[model samples]
Target chain A: MTVQISDTARPAAAGTSSGRSLRNLTYRPEAGALIGTLGVFVFFAIFGGTHFLASAGTAAWLNVAAELGIIALPVGLLMIAGELDLSVGSVLAASSMTMAIVSGYWGAPMILGIVLALGVGVTAGALNGLIVTRTNVPSFVVTLATLFGMAGLTLGLSRVITGTTSVALNPDPGSKAVFGTLIAGQFEVAILWWIVVALGVGWMLQMTKYGNWILAVGGDKESARAAGIPTNRLKIALYTGSGFGAALVGVIQTILYNGAQVANGQSFVFNSIIAVVVGGVLLTGGYGSVVGIVFGTLTFAIVNQGIYYTGWNSDWASFILGVLILAAVLMNNTFRRLALSHAPRSGKKA
Target chain B: MTQPLLRLTDVGKSFVGTNALEDISLEVHAGQVLCLLGDNGAGKSTLIKILSGFHAPTSGTIEVDGQPVVFKSPRDVSAYGIATVHQFGGTFQLMSVGRSFFVGVEPTKGWGPFKRFDKGLAGEIAVREMQSLGITRVTDGKRLVGSLSGGERQALAIARAVYFGANILILDEPTAALGVKEATHVLRIIMQARAKGVAVIFVTHNVLHAMMVGDHFAVLIHGRKADDFHKGERTREQITDLMAGGEAMADLEAELAALEASAGSTGRS
Candidate 1:
C-alpha cells in the first residue's frame, strides 16, 4: 500500500515541475483593471492636454472619485462577501438630509448634525442587515426596498420639518475643516478620508482573520459554517460597515456643498458597483482586493470626468461609461482564465 | 478492552414524519477504520450527520470515551475532537491552501489593534502537514484550493482534520469523485491517519475501496444495520450483496425479468 501510494504521488510530483513557473504578470486578478485604467488615463491625457493633468483639473474628478471610492471600498467588500448594498444611495441622501435639517434648519451644533447624519446611516444599515438575515431575503431586494423607503422618509421629513425638499447648512470652521475642507485649495479633504478608509479596510480584508471569514462566507456559506466560521455575524458586520461608508460620504457631501437635496445621491447606487466591478471585485463575491477596487474607482473617475475635458458631447458620457465598463470586465475575465490555466514547472518535488 | 473513541447505540433520526435513520448502532476504536457501507437512501448521510452533530438523533445515545455526550451543534462536537470532511472536502476553492487550512481557527500575531493573521506560520504548517500526508506536490501554500485536483483536495481536508486534533474523523465519500489513482491516494491518507491513532469512520458505497482499508464493517440498509463484522469475517461479495439489501436484489431482478419478458412477447406479436 505504501509503495502504491508513492507511485500515485509520482504523477503529481511530475506535474509540479512546471507549476513553479512564475505566473504571467498580466494574469493576476487586478491586471485587467490596471491595464484598463492606464488605457483610459493615456487616452484622456492626450486628448484633455496638460490642463486635465494639472492639479485643479485633476481634482475635478479626484473629488468625485474620493467620495465614490469611499463608498466603493465597503461596497466592494460587501460584494466580495457575496452581498449588495443598493440602499447606499438612499443612505447617502438620507444622511445628508439629516445633517442639513439638524444643523441648518434646527439650529443644532455642527457636531450634533454630523453625529446624527452618521447615526442614521448606521441605524439603516443595521436594519438592512437584520431584515436580510432574519427574513432570508436577497440583499439586493431588501436594500432596494430600503433605498426607496429611506428616500421617501427623507423627503417626507424634510418637508414636514423644514418646509422644503432641500436644506442648507453653515458649518462651523472646526467641523468644516475636518470633514468639508479641500486640502491645498485643490484636493478635497474627502481624498484624505478616502485614503484612510482604503488603508483601514484594506488591512482588515487582507491581514486579519476576519478577512478570511468574509471570503469563506462568500465562497460557500455552508462550507464556511461547516468550518465553524460565524457566517451570519460576519455578513451583518459587512452590511453595517457598508452603511458607515455611505453615511460618511453623505456627511462629507453635506458639509462640502453646504446643502442637501432629496433627489441627490441616486447615481451612487450603480456608480459604486461599477467602480468595484471594474476594479476586479467579483460580483458573485469571494474574490477581490482593496487595491483593485481603488484602481477601479480611479478608472471610473477618470472616464466620467475626462469626457468633459476632451471637448466631447456631454450627453455621450453615459454611453462611453457603459462601453468602458463592459470592456474592463471582459478584459478581467480573459486574464482570470489565463491565470487559472497557468500550469506548474513540473521538475521539483516537496 | 480499551474504550472506543466513539460509540452510537440505537441511534435514530426523523424529520417531518419521515424516519431518515433508525436504530443504528456502531462503535469505532482509536487507530481503527470503520467503513460504513450503504446504498442510496440507506441512511448513510443521516448517520454521518448525527455522528458529526449536524443532526440530533431522535432516539439512542452517543457515547464518547465511555461517557454519554449530547452534541448541540457541530462546534460542540468539534470541541470534543470530532471532525467531518464532506464529499467535496469542505474547502473554500478560491482561498489559498494555507488560508483554507487555518480558516476558522487562524493564528494571529501582534498586539491588540495591530493583530493580524500569521500568514507565514499558516503557510509553513500547511505545507509541512500536507507533505507529511504524502501530498508532495502542494509545496506552495499559496496555491488556490480550486487549482488542486480532487484527490489532493481530499488529502488536504483529511490532513487539516488530523492536524487540528481530530481524534474521531468522519469522511463522507472522500474517494467517490476521484479516479482510481486518486482514490488510492485518499486510502493511503486514511491509513496514515489511522496509524497516528485517529478513529476514522469512512462512509462510502464502494465495496472494494471499503474492503481495502476497513478493519471493522457495518452495512446499513433502510436506516438499519443489516450486518456488522470485523476484518476476515465477511468477504467482499457478501458485503456487496448485503449493501444491495439481499432479498431486495432478488425482487429487483424479478421486476427487470418481467419487463424483459413483456417486451419479448410484444416484439414476437
Candidate 2:
C-alpha cells in the first residue's frame, strides 16, 4: 500500500523537495522571474548601448518601474488572492485630480490634498470590495465599471472645477522632497517608496498569518472557509490594499510631474498586471512573490524605456510590450514546469 | 456507563419540502468508533452535516456532554471539539503542509500588528503530529498538501483535528476514493484516533471497512434508521440485507432469474 501510494504521489512530490541546495534553486518561486529579468536586461543593455547603462538612462526606466512597482505589488497580492482590480487606472486619475484641485487649484494645504486624494482611492477601493463581496459579481466586471465611472468623474470634475482637464501643483519644498523630489538629481524619490512598499508587502505575503490566509483563499476558497479561515474579509482587505496602492501612485505621479491629467493613468491598469505577470505571479492566483513583481516591474520598465535609447520608432512600444508579455509568460511556464518536474541527482525517494 | 460525548435524539431534517433525514437517534462515546452506514441517497450526508454543524436538525435535539446545544454553524460545532474531515480531507492543495495544518487557528508570535505566523512552530508541530499518526513519510512540513497521497492526506487531516483538541472526529467517507492499501492506512488512523480516547463517527457504506473499526453501527435507509446494533450483534450478510431494504433484494433476484430464464428460452428457440 505504501509503495503504491508513493508511486502515485511521487510525481507531485518530486519537484517540491524542501532541502536547501544548488539543485533546489531551480524550484524557487522567483527563479523564473529572475531569469526573465536578467535575460531582458542583457538583451536591452546590448541594444540600448552605453547610454542605456548610464545613470540618466537607468533613472528613466527606474522611475517608470518605481511607479508601476508600487501598484504592481498590491495588484500582485490581489491576483494571488484570486481577484483582479481593473479600476486602478481611474483611481490614479481620480486621486491625481483630487490632489491637484485641492492643493494646486484651491490652494489648500498640500497635506490636505494628499489626504483627500488618498481618501478618494480608499473609498473607491472599499466600494469595490463591498460590491465584490456583497453582490458576488466578478471583480473584473465590478472594477471595470469603477474604471469607467472614475474616469468620467475625474474628467467631468476637472473640467467643471478647474475649467480644464489638466491642473498644476507646485508642492511646498518639504512635501516635494518627501513625495516628488529626485534623488541625486535623476532618481525619483518614488523609488524609495517602491522599495518600502515591496518590503512591507513582502513581509505581509510571506511572514504574516494574513499571507497564509491569502494563499489559502486563493488556493481554494471552499476549503479555506471549511477550515474556518475568514475568506471574505481577507479578500476585501486585499481589494482595499490594491486600491490604496493605486492611489499612492497617483499622488506620486501628480507631485513628481507637478500636474494631473484626467486621461494620464489608463496605461497603468494593464501595465501593472503586465509587470505582475512578468514577475512570475500566476494569473490564476494562489502563487507569487513581491520580489518577483519587483523584478517584473524592472523588466517591463526596461522594455518600455529602452526603445527610446535604441532609436526605434516609439510606435512599436505597445507591439513590443505584447511580445514581451507573451514571451515572459511562456518562459515562466517552462521554468515552473522544470522546477516542478523532479529534483536533480540527490535522490530522496518519497 | 459514562455519558456519551454526543447524543442526537429523534433528529430529523428537511430541505425546502423534501425530507433528507428522519428520526435518527444515536450516541457516540469517547474511545469508541460509531460507524454510520448507508447507501447513496440514504440521508448519511444530511445526518453527518447535522452532526458536524453544517446543517441544523429541523426537529429533535443534539446534546453535547448531556447538555442540549444548538450549532448555528460549523465553527460553532468545532468550538465544541467536533471536527469533520470531508471526503477530500478538506485541505488546501497549494498550501504547504505546515500552513494547511495550522491554517484557521495558526500559532502566532509577537504582539498586535507585529504578530506573525510562527512557521517554525507550525512546521515542527505538523511534522510531529503527522509522524505520531504513522505518516512518517511527511518529513518536511514545507511539502505541499497536493503532493501527499490520499491516505496520507487523510492522516494529516485527522492528525490536525486531534492536535487541535478535537474530541469528536467525524470522518465523512474518508476511504471512499482510496485504493485498498490506502484504505488500510485510513482504517489504522481511525483505530489510532479511537485509541487516543476521541469519539469518532466513521461514515461509510462499505461493510467490511465499517466492521474493521466500528464498535457501534447505525444503518440509514431512505432517511430512516433501519437498524442500530453493537459490533457482534449483526452478521455481515444481515447488515448487507438491511442496507438493501431487507428482502427487497430477494424480490429483485427472483425477477432477474425469471428474465434470464426467458432470455435463455428465446436463445434456444
True contacts kept of each: 0.54, 0.49
lDDT of 1 by residue, B172-254 (tens): 99999999999999999999999999999999999999999999999998888999999989888788878887788889999
Residue-wise C-alpha lDDT for candidate 2, range A1-350, written one tens digit per residue: 33432332221122222566765555556677767777776777788887877778778888898889889989899998889999999999999999999999999999999999999988888889899989999989999999999899889989999899999999988889888999889889988888778878988888888889888888778777877888788878888888888899989889989989999789999999999999888788877777778878888988899888888798988898898899888988776665444332334565
Residues A20-61 of candidate 1: C-alpha lDDT, one tens digit per residue: 334545545567776877788789888988777776667787
Candidate 2, residue B18: Cα displacement in angstroms equals 0.9
Native contacts recovered by model 1: 0.54
Stretches > 4 Å off in candidate 2: A1-20, A311-316, A330-350, B111-114, B246-269
Model 2, residue A139: C-alpha shift (Å): 1.5
Candidate 2 lDDT (Cα, whole model)? Answer: 0.86
Give TM-scores of chain A for all candidates.
0.91, 0.91
Clashing pairs in 1: A16-A346, A17-A345, A17-A346, A17-A347, A18-A344, A18-A345, A18-A346, A19-A344, A19-A345, A20-A345
